[model samples]
Target: MMHKPVVDENERRARQEAHLLVREFGAEAPLYAAMKAEKAIEQKDFGRCARWKRVLEILADEPPADLRRSAAAK
Candidate 1:
């Protein structure tokens, strides 16, 4: 009989956290919004980029409690 290798607890937890991130932020609408904004920056759309940059700044500054918990759990 062949046996599958066991996953480490930390690795299992990481997978769970990754799933949550995807669930929370990987919806089509939100992903499209972020991508569109990022593309605007790439195209030298400074005005749009500045606006999107502020949005990103807000997201970056406010790390979710669940994310923090996951980091601390590691």
Candidate 2:
């Protein structure tokens, strides 16, 4: 008979959940845009950051009524 270590499924699930949360926040489209802007600032990439920041700003603006309505449907 071979002995094997048992893994706790609950712990694995918890780690997966935590990883998902981090990814959701980290790679979020809008958040990525914001982070890009910040990175550009650090690198003195004014033009690049300006473009990304503009994108972030535009995304932050109010969406059209229809879009907002549709997004709220869920």
Q: What is the lDDT of residue 73 in candidate 2?
A: 59
**Model 1 lDDT tens row, 1-74:** 99999977645543444435444664332344367578987898876655555444434444545444554576
Candidate-wise lDDT, in order: 0.53, 0.53
- Global local distance difference test of model 1: 0.53
Off by over 4 Å in 2: 1-27, 62-74
Model 2 C-alpha lDDT per residue in residues 1-74, reported as the tens digit of each score = 99787756644443333333334443354666677779999999897776676555544553334223433453
- Candidate 1 positional error at 30, Å: 9.2
Clashes in model 1: which pairs?
none
